[model samples]
Target: MMYDQLKVLEKTIIDIKKKYQLVNDELNSLKQKPNTDPKELAALKTQLSNYRNEHDSAKKQLGDLDKRYQNLAEAHHMIGEEQDKLHKQLADLQRKNSELQQHNDQLKQQNHDIKQQNHDLQEKNQLAAERTQVVLKRLTRIDQMEG
Candidate 1:
C-alpha cells in the first residue's frame, strides 16, 4: 500500500511539473505574439493574468499535497511502531497468564480499528488522485481551446 501511494504521489508530481512547463511555454508564446490593437492586447493580458493566477494556485496545491504525503508517511511509520509494540505486549501477556486473554482480544480489536483507519486514508488518497486527474484534464482542454 505504501508503494502504491508512493507511485501515485510520484505521478502527481510529474503531472504537475508537466502542466507547469506547458503553462510557462504558453505564456511565452503569447508574449511573443505581435498585437496591433490595444483592445486585443488588453484581452490577451487579462487572459495571461488569469493563467498566471491559475498556475500559482496549482503550485500551491501541489505544495499542499507534498506536505500531506509527508504527514501520511510519518503517520504510517508511527503506526508501524505502535503495532510492533502492541504485538510485543500481547505476546508478553500471553506468556504471563491465561487471564490476559481478554486483554489480548482487546488489542486485536484495536489493531483491527487501526487497519480500518488506514484503509479509509487510502481511499481518500485515491479519491484525491481522481479529482486531480479530472482537474488536469479540464486544464488541458482549456489550454487547447485557448491555443
Candidate 2:
C-alpha cells in the first residue's frame, strides 16, 4: 500500500514539474513578445508558484514513505532470522530427546537381564539349602547309631 502511494506521489511530482516548466516557458515567451498583458503574466507566475509548492510537498512525502518502507523491510528480515534460529533449536531438542529415549530403552533391557540373573541365583541358593539339610540329617542319624 505504501509503495502504491509512493508511485502516485512520484507521478504527481512529475506532472507538477512538467506543468511548471511549461508555464515558465510561456512566461519567457511572453517577455520576448512586444505586446504582452500584465494580468496574464501575473496569473502564470502564481500558477507556477503553486505547482512548486505542491512538488516540494510531494517530494517530502515520498522521502518519508521511503524511510518507513526501509524500516519495515529491516524488521521483516530480523523476524525471519529469529524464526530460523528457533527452528534450529527445536531440531536440536528433538535430536536430544531421541538420544535420551534410546538410552532409556538400553537401561530397561539391562534391568530385565539383571532381574533374570537374580531369579536364577535364588533358585540355585534354594537347591543348595535343600542339599545341605539332607546331608545334616544323614550325619545326625549316623551319630545316634554310634552312640
Computed on alpha carbons, the lDDT of every model, listed in order, comes to: 0.90, 0.79
lDDT of 1 at 37: 97
How far does residue 119 in candidate 1 sit from its true spot (Å)? Answer: 63
Q: What is the lDDT of residue 111 in candidate 1?
A: 100
Per residue, candidate 2 scores C-alpha lDDT tens digits across 1-147 of: 545755665676577667657766865785677747778768866866785686577667657766866776677779889999999999999999999999999999999999999999999999999999999999999999999
Residue pairs with backbone atoms closer than 3 Å in model 2 (clashes): none
On lDDT, the leading prediction is: 1
Candidate 1 lDDT for residue 104: 87
The prediction achieving the highest TM-score against the true structure is 2
Query: Whole-model lDDT, candidate 1?
Result: 0.90
Candidate 2, lDDT over the whole model: 0.79
User: How many steric clashes between backbone atoms does each model show?
Assistant: 0, 0
